[model samples]
Target chain A: MNPVLGRVFPGLEGRSLRAAAVVTVLGGLVGVIGGESVVLALVLALAGSLATLSLRGRPNPLAEEYGLLPAIAALGALAALATPSLLVGLLAGVAGLGLLLWNAESARDTVRTAEPVEGLLIPGLGLAIALLTALSLPTASAAVGAAAFAVVVALALVVWALQGALTADPYAAKAL
Target chain B: MSGGSADPGPLKFRPRAVALFGAAGALAVLALATHNAVPLFLALPLLLGPAAAATGAPRVPLSFRVTWSSEGSRGEVEITGRLTPSAAGPSAGVVPTFYRPEPLIDRAPPEVRSEAEGIAFRLHWSAPYPCLVSVARPMLHWRDPLGLVERPVRVEGDALRLQRFPPELARASRAPLRRTTPLPGEVRARQLGGAGEFFAIRPLAPSDTLRQVNWRATARAGRMLANDFRVERTGDLLIVLDLRPTSLGSEIDARLASVAAAGAYGLAQSFLDQKARVGLALYTDFVESIPLASGRRQRYRLLRALQAATPGETAGPSERLAVSLRRYFPPGVTTVLFSALADDESTLVLPHMRRRGFPAFVLSPSPVPLLGQLGPRPTEDDERALRLLRLVRRRRIAEAWSEAAVVEWDDYWSLSSLASFFARPAGRRAAS
Candidate 1:
């Protein structure tokens, strides 16, 4: 993350306060340039890059990890900043990012997490998929497609990261 | 077989699978809609590179047998294992890893070779102290050549429990000896001088190693004559080890312990080679002893005793040795004590052992020489005190030599010098 972000914003490591500023400004500029609604796509791209970069060393990087998450995160970020209802758009984006954060940290935490949450997660995912298909039906608005993409990719990544965390036995790999 | 290959499982996909297959699909969808070459350029190699590079992998279960290397010793052992991998499975992955359990002995990582027969390597556990060892072989990742696909497959290597033995026995010197032990052996006896290396040719007798019937002597005597030889007598030897904790610091403590163990085992091996009944007593927190015995089995017992240190029964008091000796060893056994004698209890136990009628000897590694190997004591005062304490211990050992045998080896001396104690008699030794 440090090296990649360094190429984007000189002298700013991923951990720096200014890196967040770079992400915000880049996300907002992409939205403003791509005619308003594209801001959500830009947000999804930025968010996806952050999440995947953070999970660099994990055994298997998922399809959503490299492709859909970044796209979804960029779209969500744009929606947060450019929507008429800024508060609602920000809430939706933050909620979606929160889910991604949980997925990212899943590789580190599994023992204390509830198993029932996963059971519930499956149904919640099914409903989200149904909602996504419905949104794509009204493909006249690109925002709807971006929102559905964001929801589907975020759900898929959550499961993928959790399963990966459970399977990767770091101690067993070295067999020390 | 000189070498062989094995496949434990099937070929599996990795992230490049995502990149090659998943990314390619996404790029195709995007390219179809936009007719864009930019995305194709960005995604093509990202997807194809890993899958292509990984022509495939070898997934094979591995099995191995552990044995002593041809060039290893009783005190320092080297181990070699024949590791054979099973045939390639549905998928190809790397073999399960073998690692060092602990740094008890310094060793390189297990070396591996995949050949027609199997994978052969020496485990990093080469020459670890003789004990019950613990090793783990877990399933490992098998990635394609391009690393586009990876799968976790079960490792089929055997989990082995090995009883480590001393490296190799050193030959005993054939010099005449005066042994008082009641055990039978190849040593020349003190009083029972019959049935040995030809003392004289007499009339035929029983219990003679054939070829003892001297045909020439019998022809001259006009009678069937047999050879008489000095009786080969086996003596009882008690090798005492002191593994008590000391103030010399843990590093030096470990060094001295190794020296003590090596010296004890070396001397024991020499004695055993001469067909002597050998016994071992480890004086640590408590006394661990292997009763008097001879032969290869006894050697194994002695090796096991050397490494059988329990946390509670180790790194503690030294005076416990006196009590152990009183209870365990008979009074007349030729007892040899191997210790640094850092504590008064150990040094003091020496004279008492001699007084009890044991032909007691001390093989102590003097601490003064090893001080140079140490970085420094925490303080100058501590350093001064350490040297002083060792000097006092040396004086006490020197005083005991008149009543008993003593071989004081300098810790930093060469192995040949230390080994001289076994090749020759002690500087001052007396029959008990």
Candidate 2:
């Protein structure tokens, strides 16, 4: 397994493929809320898997190499806000976290994978979008969607944390 | 042996080395200021490439094992580590180093080398003293990319410990004899004559009984042959170990304990070699009582007694050595005592054994030289002090064993000294 970040989430190519599939699912779901849902879905889907790959260990791969990762995630956050409605943004956000656990039961080899940080960041970006859209519109649907998004992300966060704590840590010993 | 390099790998940045980065920054500044794109292009990647590569370097798992091999005081060890197979990214490695406080005189730690089969190496070591092989933690040399910085990553794994036990005498070169007991055994006795293991058959004498004649010989060319046999006597012996504290470091103290163990193991070994029944008992702190019996198991009894002979709290007076001997041991059974003879109680053991009617031999380890070897160096003043110390030590030893045959084992604790000591006129009579 990859030493720090990759140790938590290992299958890169498969996860990447899943991320694409998740984007299609997310896009169709968000389309119900209308207004740039396609773009929002794609961003959230990619960000969720990325967070799954990176966020688990200390300075997951994206955050470790350079400031490059934070920059990309921030850009995706900007894209999430462009969605027309808070409902669309919230749906995209919650979907990313839920999808991180979608196939999590079949723990994959983390050697070439990213960190698990994506689980938090994608939802965090969604949250940012929900706040922006909620403030701009102040509609009951926006408030309800924001509340639902917050609840889902909070639950996902707890489960992700508990999972990290429970995982059996296998150590490597080298001759000195 | 893997070559040891003091050069710190490129994980930490030194001022002199950091000057290159400073130089790169300066060139970039100079290029823009002088309107030249050449230096900027070159310096830009120089600044970014390593940081990028270090980030992307594949992280791999490494595992290791520490194994021990030994024969008496000398042996070798194998320490090997393997990286789990991976095709994810570029190769990386771990270099581990074992740590210790005191320098090993002739022993070297395993050299670390990363190989396809994994990193492994072997090292030979010789330490004849009793010790805990080691308790120090190991560390690994971790380097980032481009040999620019090196860091120490403390390696935490299941501890590897090779218990260093005192040397056990391997040869029964000298056999100590004991007085005859009722049990039938292998010790030959001069006074006791009976039907025994066949010694020889002679021509039938006129007075020879018909039952004593060998029928086969009578039937053959020989007219008659009287069967003759040597009386086989059983002897019982007990080895007493002193368990009082010693004034020395653990290593030397262990050596002293080992010396005591050597005496006990050797004596029991020698007697067992003669097929005489032997038992072992401890004092200062009372250990279990083992009854006398002749067989292969007696060796095991002696060894277990030696292990019990570890240094502990000072208990009964040295005279108890005799009291204990008298209480448990049978009359006429010879008692061999291994003690430092440094204390008042110990000083009385020899006379006690003699007075109790048990043939006694005392093997007391001389402490002065061993003290000098393990403790502080001896100067003229130190020598004078030692001489004073020696007078007291020897006086006490002499006081207890004044009328008894005592062998004061000195600097080189070996079997030859023991053999020769026992073969001396006094020791020979004591054995008989």
Supply candidate 1's per-residue lDDT for B40. 30
lDDT of 2 by residue, B108-163 (tens): 43344455543343333443433333324345444332323335433444544443
* Docking quality band of candidate 2, CAPRI definitions: incorrect
Going through the candidates in order, their DockQ values are 0.03, 0.01
Candidate 2 error regions (>4 Å): A1-176, B1-68, B72-106, B111-173, B186-234, B246-255, B273-275, B285-287, B294-298, B374-378
State TM-scores per candidate. Answer: 0.51, 0.45
Runs with alpha carbons beyond 4 Å of true place in candidate 1: A1-176, B1-82, B86-92, B101-111, B122-196, B199-231, B249-255, B310-320, B367-371, B374-396, B399-403, B411-415, B418-432
lDDT of each: 0.49, 0.49
At residue B48, candidate 2 shows an lDDT of 34
Best candidate according to TM-score: 1
Stretch of 10 with least lDDT, candidate 2 chain A: A1-10
Give lDDT for model 2: 0.49
How high is the DockQ of candidate 2? 0.01
